[model samples]
Target: MTQSYKIVIPVFFIGFLAGAGFWYLFSPALFDRVVSEELPAGFDLSELRSGEFRDVDGAHRGSGKAQVLVSPAGAALLRFTDFEVTNGPDLEVWLVKDPDPQKSADVSASQWLSLGPLRGNKGDQTYVIPEGTNPSEWGSAVIWCEQFGVLFSVATLSEAKI
Candidate 1:
């Protein structure tokens, strides 16, 4: 191959790698979700609580409703509908004791339970709250950055009218 062609090929490969890395770190992950988890025999799906998400600050943005339900046998479920949030590395869903955490620090200092890693930045997703973890004990649901200690968004939960 010509020397010019060799140089151009290497440059193109490097550029592609850099672009992929940047997208991985900064771009949001999005996939519209549809849930269909089977409940145990005679499972009750009543007893639901829900909350609306709010931005953590000016740069961070989120809009959605978080719905929490406790099965009769004590398993909990967290579902997000029409949900969207700023994407970041190591994001995790949390249930915090504080009804309203004014800042990121408040979340770390308060009691919390990890539901799981965020499935997507924008989607309708459902996460199974581990068995024996009572979601009703806390009043807030959080989108937290585990790696950076950042609060992306939060939802202060309230009982959903039957």
Candidate 2:
């Protein structure tokens, strides 16, 4: 109603909008997403070979349990539980020969097989490794960003003493 009040309100609204836009664009990886999927009723966890996720390149954080489980009929799956990690665009799950990769070049520097595009940046997920490919041959698992060539995280695979 006052002359100064009208001008001040518009200026404040514009500033708020600008700040929100900047936050959304610049801090994409900070967002957290949780997704859930049901496992097959007959799937057995007893036969799984398990591993623990680790951070790499000082650009990633968070940890979780990784397991390679086989179905009763003989299909292989990579499962992640209690999983947490930073979010990034074009992130794909990769099984790699190198246990610790510092950059994108290292991803292709040796033999690598993609489990598939990452299901979610945070929470439990599963991936099916191609039937003929041997999971034992790969040393570790990597959450890689295909578009920007960034390694989000890595997990070294090892046999679990079940």
Candidate 3:
């Protein structure tokens, strides 16, 4: 190999390794935080677990579906699963606390704790609930499908520990 080629090759390999390490350390938590900020208020983060499902109204076929999973504390590992309306219109899911039950009556939407939106499909998204927002105050989660005009949600334990 040429003398110049030897130096270039090592530098390139080192840069690649460094980039990989950085992503490994920050990607999971960073992604989680972004998703959490989008959720509505009143939704508890500790009670979140795998395999939960939230269904919206079918009348408004344009609406969507969503779910949540709360990871161990300090890890900020919250997973959200959602299904967009393929046959009709898209929907947005939020992680709220104790939302108004009357909002599900149609026309108007509920007021949740507000975690944020479940932007995409299932299994690919994660969010981080910021510190100081005591998970103890979380009551339930609300999912509002903008296109279908429906509110789907799940009620959770107020003091459930992650």
Candidate 4:
């Protein structure tokens, strides 16, 4: 090969590697956050038990849906059976426990989980809370669409039985 051609090949390869590496390191969490914010308006958490959550048409930047379940007091026990995202960027799911539902100051730290870019028919992924998190204190669980900046939150009325 010509000298210039050899140099061009190596440069292209290096660029590809760099891009892939960057995505690998940051894409999951970043995409999740973006999708978390893009959740649709009037999307109900209670409906998730039925196994399908649909977003309002054209309300958000992208098209996607999410479901959430929590203890009566709002602790998240299982998240994922009712989840789906399509035609959008990635989504992030978080579990937040707050003793005082009206105030943000009483909220416990949040746990971040990642989902998908989901161009077509992406599957669901479930999350189980750790033992340290008290089920009764859980006030809300949120699913965020990172790209469109939407947040879908479900609040529990009492402590979860499980």
Overlapping backbone residue pairs in candidate 4 total: 23
Q: Score every model by TM-score.
A: 0.75, 0.76, 0.41, 0.35
Ranking by TM-score: 2, 1, 3, 4
Task: Indicate the residue-level lDDT of 51 in model 2.
Answer: 74
- Best-performing candidate as measured by lDDT: 1
Residue 52, candidate 1: C-alpha displacement in angstroms: 0.5
User: What TM-score does structure 3 among the candidates reach?
Assistant: 0.41
Error of 1 at 44 (Å): 3.6
Error of 1 at 27 (Å): 3.9
Tens-digit per-residue lDDT, 1-162, candidate 3: 699899999999999999997776545324422222244445455544333343344432222222344545443334444432222223344455553343465225333444555554323355555665554444444445555555644333333334
lDDT score of residue 1 within candidate 3: 61
**Candidate 1 accuracy as TM-score:** 0.75
- Judged by lDDT relative to the true structure, which candidate is superior, 2 or 4? 2
Across residues 1-162, which tens digit of lDDT does each residue of candidate 1 receive? 698998999999999999998887766544332344333456577657899999989877789988897776677788888888887788899999999997899998999998888877877777788887777778899999998899989999988887
Clash counts per candidate, in order, are: 0, 0, 25, 23
Give candidate 2's error at residue 157 in angstroms.
0.4
Give me the runs in candidate 3 sitting further than 4 Å from their true place. 1-51, 60-75, 81-90, 99-111, 146-149, 153-162
Q: Give lDDT: candidate 1, residue 30.
A: 42
lDDT of 2 by residue, 17-124 (tens): 999977865566777678876666766655456678877646676599888877666688888888877787777898998866666688769678887888787888
RMSD of each: 4.0, 4.9, 14.7, 10.5
In Å, residue 157's CA in model 3 sits off its true spot by 5.8
